[model samples]
Target: MNLYPFRCSLALMAMVGAVISCSKQTTDPMEMTSLPGDTVLNVNYESGTLSSGVTGISSTHASAVDANYMVQPGAKGSYAIAHKVVYGDTAYYSDGAYRSESDAVALPAARFAPGDERRYEFSVLLKDWTPWLSGAIHETNIFQLKVSGNSTTGSGVPLQVRVARNALRLRYADNIRVYNFLADVRPYINQWIHFRIDAKWTLDATGYIRTYMKLPGHSFTIVDEKTNYATFAGNPAVGNIGYIKWGIYGIQEGLTRIAYHDDIRIIRLN
Candidate 1:
């Protein structure tokens, strides 16, 4: 008998509930915060330029070498650095994009001592893998941490992350270490992968370098952990400063390799 009035009351209640629900929705943006601890270099490459103030020098060539290296759109953001090393490219065997600083960040002889730890994190995507030949060596340095000496000799650690003919390889000093983390990584081509290096620079038996890698849809797995690694010679007179250079280096003859990188971070953990 009073069904009309009951329906009207129900509609009014529904309208009030709608208004309350709408009011609860927030239009304000979320705030962003930096990660805890000290950061020496944090480059996301969103600026579309290699000169992001993390280092004083960004280069495609160390000594008149020429390769295609530029900041383009990337996986994690709107910008990423792409490096292309083609066979017969002019300049030294060293070719690709790199940012360098002298004794800055965690590379100083004073900053990274025995028991001091530093973390280097970055993401890499292998856009194109160089073709492989039977029994041939296809080694390229994708990331490098070099300890520069006085104009005569240069020594440091280099990550041969891309070895086209076989699995990934890492070259530190005269030693070559291979990893199956990306064994037959051809299937993961064009997919972003994560790489990390936690280094404790020292001359004695206490020194170590722990390497971690994360494939898509997977957590970071330790690829290698080496103790007494020759990351740096104890003699400060040889070189007290170090620098980081990432991008395709040591391009093999007759092969063209391309890769993209983003979110490079260097942190000092005291």
Candidate 2:
């Protein structure tokens, strides 16, 4: 809402010798890898890598109605942009297509497009209830949202108010658990539990240059598990790859339930 996020949280606990520095503006080649036990990040995962836009670049998902996963009015619709799923009964689309529900499951705000060095990979599968606003649901096999928007959400930008590169999180609250907001890092229902996330942001001129992320399963260790490197600090004027985003996010009364996201892969992180 104010967008001043330069909270390097301490650069992941810096001063160890100070190798942690980010404001994003680069020449590319600041590689730092580690996160492979079993992969699922697509776009062409030989092992992992991509980067090439400005061309016919295209990718999208998230859209449903009479089946479940509502919210498709006008800011526009398409399930938030493209990429959605949540089934214990229904709300899917990895190719299964089972859209048709209405007991009450509203979530808007999460359109997709992560340009720049683009290598976005997200994973889902949650069931956090226990104090997660209530507690004892446990379907969290893994969860992730490794980002790297670098910049641009339209308007003067600055909605979630914090983008020293990209980490704009607007939550419905719960640093961890207790109604588990901010999408609960990637939570809502908790059953189909199986998520994936791989990120890559590399722009420059002061916005980003290197934002690599890898989402491994069973990694739902809990507590935002280091909110994406938990080391903000990267804002080279900000600007990476963007186009569509809304993911309205939900939660507020009735605690929580109904969350599923499947096989979403945006690539360019070669």
Q: What's the lDDT for all of these models?
A: 0.61, 0.27
- Each candidate structure's count of clashing pairs: 1, 64
- What lDDT is obtained when candidate 2 is compared to the true structure? 0.27
**Which consecutive 10 residues in model 2 have the weakest lDDT in total?**
100-109
TM-score of 1: 0.71
Give per-residue CA lDDT, model 1, range 1-270, as digits (tens): 669999999999999999987655422111112347577677777766655445553645434323434546676788877766656645434423321111133434323544567777778887767456576575666676655453355444434355546566666654556554455777767888888887877656676777788789987778877776555543455555555666776555666677777887777755
Cα-based lDDT at residue 147, candidate 2: 30
- For model 2, state the Cα shift of residue 100 in Å: 10
TM-score of model 2 vs. true structure: 0.23
